[model samples]
Target chain A: MKAPSLQNTLLVTGLFTASFAQAAELEITVENLTRGIAFTPILIAAHDMESHLFVTGEMASTELQAMAEGGDISGLEMVATSVAADMATNPAGGLLMPAMSTTTMLSTEQMNTQLSLVAMLLPTNDGFVGLDSWTIPETPGTYSVYLNAYDAGTEANDEVRGSGTPGEAGMPVPPPLENVIGMNGTGVAASITNDKVHIHPGNIGDAEIDGGSSDIQNTVHRWLNPVAKVTVVVSE
Target chain B: MTIRLLRMSVATALLIMLAACSDDNDDSVTEVPEEPEMRTFEVSVFNLSANQPLSPIAVIASDGGMLWHTGEAASDGLEALAEGGDNSVLIGADSTLGSTSGDAPLGAGESEMLTLSLEAGSETSISVASMLVNTNDAFSGITGVDLTTWAVGETKTYLPAVYDAGTEENTEMAGTIPGPADGGEGVSEGREALDAVTMHSGVVTADDGLPDSVLDSSHRFANPVMKIIISRVE
Candidate 1:
């Protein structure tokens, strides 16, 4: 026990140090790919594997419904804070417009290895772009994930101008996007037929920009899956 | 037995020397000879349609560049592929490394495998494309997927979602669709009513209230219209 060999100590310590250096730092970038859609202030969280901000086919929680229906992230922010997640709120400082992107650096504080992002799609009743918990890779490389649009299932897709409060009747077209929306359009539909969170049937815009069944422009407002492209670079 | 032991010891020493030589070579690549090497990948594509038959597949290996981007207008080559399912122009278009096409069209519930081999170190990304021939200008595939993570003999499968080329309108008219459903026009010259590309709203057939549409409800489709798998075979 008293052999006091220096090389063995240095080797063991070096191995431990190398293991510590292997932890990854990620650079995350999110792009809004819609032609006319606007994303509300986004919320990105790095949390444990056991938690999820939103899940499909389940009833939307009060917090998620609040964000999806009204483009408000306060309730969801409170939830992420409750779990003590490494979170970034409103990286774009406001709405992320079509074809625009925002980047942020995420530092994972050990055991927090999953990433999730959420933002309400503007000019919709209750649609949002979502990237559910994706595992952060341990290897150093660039990874890309595309996000799809989801219905919050809390309100009917009336596709008209209305309130930003939860349980509202129509979509909230914020001030900057207000002028582009149409006027004098009868509501698209009036019933909350599907009550569970599911894939959005997509917006049904009409040919008449001045007076259509929906306020959103069919040519400019329609979108496909992968509404947002996210690029993540992991660094050792 | 002594000779066998000698050979074993020689092999062990050679392996150690080789490992050391590789590490040194990593630092001094100037002495290494540069030779042309070939990298190959096989693209397995599946048609996930009820009735809409896809055109022959077109696979291209290119640099980390995009063949097309959403919210932008389509190039002439992409316009040709979207309108008619004729990949002749796209296969030879710009931003291409190497391209391969299927022998025949893929019908409903069918599959096709096309092998695309590229010269090693020539390209960093792969783009696969094909047309949903029954629609006006809808196509589905992947673009600019980096290949550094892929290795020889490893496979990666991708389920592709449909995209509107934004070159032609989704008119669904009788003489507009190029597939057997219409046997109509392919690659009409001119501009579309809307020039920007977006997610396809899907085919609105006569059953869905588009009376002039020659297509039926069977032509309808959802997000992921095709399934694709790529393996670096060599």
Candidate 2:
């Protein structure tokens, strides 16, 4: 677990040069910290600084939109391939239920100094949990980062049940999520205000389990920022 | 960044001087620098729930490991802590350098400080856990936190978020809770629903339209249910 001293390594090489020659193996653990929401297959990718999954204040790419709106990772997987990023897709097999964690080992190749993760938040139209391009520390240590929910800005959050297709109107309630999520929720909103990727304002679900407002449970599905925690142990 | 550079230069000069003083052939006397003491941290948790008191605080000090990570199922020890407000099992099982607990329950707005000391070593992390007594299985605590740069006598304060132990279900029934709010049952062993620790969605009190809930709005809370302060005490 011990790496060469960074002070000595820096003395012998340039900061960027030393980074190019040495890469740390990352042990990543992701936890779903919600009482009710379920996450579709998560996508964890390590890429160079040039690659980005989704950025704020910009329109989501068709690939990003697909994953955010439909819980599909095929489009994002292609994007990861295009950037030559190291990726681990759907490590949990299918949906990651509440209070569940998926532990995975990821080793970054030289030049992949940034990490990005994305997964659709079940019972939502275009909502997803996301971690944007975070700089990987050069120091060998364990780092923890909390992720927040985001709106992909691709579709309206109708809060009802419908198709899982991209650009669809309502939320896609899969089997496990269907039983938990309420049915015939009137709707949350007809459209979105901000048409770019942004922090999700959290679901505004009603207390009624049978039918009132949102299909999602209010006291159950609601969450603050940092809905997920990522613990990365960097090894030499 | 300039001040950091100055500090590094000073350290480098001191290190070079120390290196120069070393003799290749030490026949008489030699001096070896003492390894750094493992950093020790003392964390105190204060329960601030209205009708919901807290179970005994579970204080654990580890290098960088977590007792119960989010999205993970509550271990038996953590489940015991969340369900019954008992820290005996968790504190007993914690493999940290040191673990301690408050003697009695911490009531609403009333605070008590429990001291935990770890020998100074490379392991410079601390974690503290506790449960709200009125709910089904709501608990809260700070997790593997780096206390490396905290100098002796310095103090750090935080308001920790509440977490559902995910052991017992959040039924909020009168006979399910252990706090005075219910004067109800304690730990009943049974895996109800999703058995994993997650962020507590908070109580759906009888005041909030959950007809079955024994808790009222006074029992509800938002993020940061507890104010935690950690001080480095040699």
Best by the DockQ measure? 1
Question: Quick one: how many clashes does candidate 1 have?
Answer: 0
In DockQ, how does model 1 score against the reference complex? 0.03
| Candidate 1 per-residue lDDT over residues A1-236, each given as its tens digit | 54566778988889876654334578889999989899999999988777889865457899999899888899988988888778888999999999999999888766677889999999888889998789888788999998888777688777778877888788887889978888766777576644555556577666666766677777888787779999999986
TM-score of 2: 0.49
What DockQ do you compute for every candidate structure? 0.03, 0.02
Residue A173, candidate 1: Cα error in Å is 1.0
Query: Considering only N, C-alpha and C atoms within 3 Å, which residue pairs clash in candidate 1?
Result: none
Off by over 4 Å in 1: A1-23, B1-234
TM-score of each: 0.53, 0.49
Q: Is the docking of candidate 1 incorrect, acceptable, medium or high quality?
A: incorrect
lDDT per residue (tens digit) for residues A1-236 in model 2: 23568777766678667546356598888899887788999999999888899865457899998898889999999999888898889988899988999989988888788999999998778889988888788778999998878777677666778877887788887888767778777776675644666556556677777777677777787777678998888886
